[model samples]
Target chain A: MKPTRVTNTIRALRFAHDEMTQADLAERIGVTRQTVIAIEQGRYSPSLEMAFRIARVFGVRLDDVFQYPDSEEVAP
Target chain B: MSKILYLGEAVVTHEEKRAWIMLVVSVIAYAGYVAVVLGRQDGGSLTAVPYVGALLWTVGGAMVASIVAEIVMGMANPRASRVKDVRDREIGRLGDHVGQAFVIIGAVSAMLMAMAEWDWFWIANVIYLCFVLSAVIGSLAKVIVYRRGVPQW
Candidate 1:
């Protein structure tokens, strides 16, 4: 069965980080604000590189910002 | 200031009335043209006239419409054609991908038809089908990508 799922608080985290605008994060990571919006809303799952970039921007590990609610996800 | 370039606001530059007028005129013209082609005294050959006329008329009309619309829009706002956003880029990319698929599918089908001794009429139909299908599928993909928040493709 597909388990009940949940999403992240990247938007909240960004706000906590001095109210960073989507444009600011997008510019830092060479994407667009629309892409940033998509990610924060869980409508898009970013590529590994993009996830790392977002983590770097937040000055934290990737897991600190994003996590799948299920416990069976692969670890690298 | 590091060379501040002003971004133009999004607004409907081309008047809807002008656009609708152009639309109706083009539709009437094309329909009249097709009717004339179909009503010939000799009732000319389907291969010789109707199909060719359609391919010519539809494409010619579309080109004319695009040019007219672009000109009208540009008249209202010089930068009406510029789209400097990620959503626009993704939509265009989605179109390009669908178009590529159409070309590949058409070419393969044409080659198979050629091997079976199909003639030039078949090739012409194949080309027309390629273009029509490409446009339809491309537009559909664009809508899908845009509403669904970006496509993996």
Candidate 2:
């Protein structure tokens, strides 16, 4: 499958928060560690509610956690 | 030590194991049915072979086997998390959708065969084949998604 256009900073946020493990973040967000791994690797894009929940765990805004590539940014 | 083994082994989730179980059981059951029916052919008309009993036994056996396998797996891995997370649910839904297409095809084929005055053997076998294909393909899809990540959109 193609990588998701959405990118996230979950790994960075997890590192900032006492170097939290993926399992810890998954438990906090009610998802599997694999889901967290996928999201961090840009292999899967979380649902809107899930995205908010993830950001809430990191105490950040949705955009702070996730970013969509801009059309202009893609065109070199 | 367990840590060394863990580092060497690929991480697998409970749902992925269940998918593997389903895929394996379906293929085995279908193969068993085919074997029994073909073995009975005895150089005669294939339709005359008694397939209903074999079909029923294999299908029923598959269900029982799957449940038993799952129970055994759970018993063996007492510490494995049994929770079905959102990603698991989504993957299951996606797999079911992919599998359901084969079910529709099976149903349509059965209907057409019945209308065409085909023997019960052909109709029943067609439906059974499709059901097995559905289970196999669906489980495969789930395994692939688990390994490769769910497709976005």
Candidate 3:
């Protein structure tokens, strides 16, 4: 199977949300700020619940914020 | 900050009791070991009494610290450390990797030293340095794994 890396527009989304800090985002999602950071840096991919929580924060569809390496197929 | 996301606090549990315990025990053991090693020098002062005590103290300290850590973690969250977490497993994995690296380096260095006309100091340093580096790297690896999650084995 493929080792799919998480790719996200979280930085852009945060900026659009009135320059919300990583701390702000993490608090809203009920996880640590470091977790938000790891997610943004692609060092960590959050749980599905966390992903949805993040998407909801930016008021965007999950796909809008998070993209798979392959545009057509499901993530590995 | 927004409650939905950045609760803002990253409160890793306080293992102060265990930490302090380890700190005192470790310091004393290290001091004892150093004293014994130094006493055996050319300007030797003490007898072999300190050497025996140092060995016992170091081994005892390590064993006690391990148990204390386990107990403290168990108290903090019985479920959390029920089995090895992603963090511990990752740390162990990295420790194993670094340990293997040190073993290879030590073997090569010792072989080279055996063939060459060098003092025991060089060979001793090689052996000591590998052991220390493996431990330090292993400890740092634990911190990294805890900070950054590892889902896969």
Candidate 4:
């Protein structure tokens, strides 16, 4: 599968939060650890609701957790 | 030891393990059924070989095997979370969509065969084969998605 255009700073955020384990973040966000891993790795772009939930877990704005490349940068 | 555990952790998820178990059990059960039916074909027509009992037993056995395998997996990996999250649900839906194509093909084939007055043996076997194909392909799809990561459109 193509990698999701949406990239995230979740790993960095997790690190900032005392080197939080993926499992702990998952628990806080009500998702499985693997889902957290997928989001962190940019393998899966989450649903809007899930995106909000993740942002809530980190106590950050959604943009702080996820970003998409500028349209001009992605064009061929 | 840490490296090995990390490697194991990186490789598979609980859902992937279930898919692997389903794939293996389906293959084994289908192979066993074929072997028994073929062994009974002692110079008689393949269609004439009694197959109903074998089919029933194999189907039932596969169900039991899948249940037992899941139980054993849970026991072995008690630490692994059994809950399905959003990603798991999406993957399952996608895999089922892929597998359902075979099921529809099987159903249509059976209907046509019945209309043409084909032998019951051929019709039954075709349905059974499709069912096995559905299981094999579905679980295989799930495993691949788990490895490759779910496509986010």
Please name the candidate that would achieve the greatest DockQ relative to the true structure. 4
* Consecutive 10-residue window with the lowest summed lDDT within model 4 chain A: A67-76
Q: Write the per-residue lDDT of candidate 2 for residues A11-72, one digit (tens) a residue.
A: 88887887777878878888877777778888678899999999999899999999987765
- Residue lDDT tens for model 4, B35-146: 9999999989999999999999999999999999999988987877777888889889998998999999999999999999999999999999999999999999998887
lDDT of each: 0.61, 0.87, 0.60, 0.86
| Cα RMSD, each candidate | 8.0, 3.2, 9.0, 3.0
- For A1-76, candidate 4 gives per-residue lDDT tens digits of 3557889998888777777778777788788778887788887788899889888887999999999887755556
TM-score of 4: 0.89
The candidate 1 chain B region of ten consecutive residues with least summed lDDT is B1-10
Per-residue error at B117 for model 3, in Å?
A: 12
How well docked is model 4, in DockQ terms?
0.38
Candidate 1 docking classification: incorrect
- Native contact fraction per model: 0.11, 0.27, 0.07, 0.34
Give the residue spans of candidate 2 off by over 4 A. Answer: A1-3, A72-76, B1-10
lDDT digits (tens) for residues B1-153 of candidate 1: 211121233422122223344445445545665565566526556445545666577768766876777677667777443424444565567667876788788888889988888876677768656765665566566555544555443
Q: How would you order the candidates by DockQ, starting with the best? A: 4, 2, 1, 3
Taking the tens digit of each residue's C-alpha lDDT, what string does model 3 give over B1-153? 543354333334223223334445445545666665676655654332235455555657666866877677667666331322222343467656855677678878888997896666556546655654555555555445445544343
Better of 2 and 3 by TM-score: 2
lDDT of 2 by residue, B38-95 (tens): 9999999999999999999999999999999999998987877777888889899999
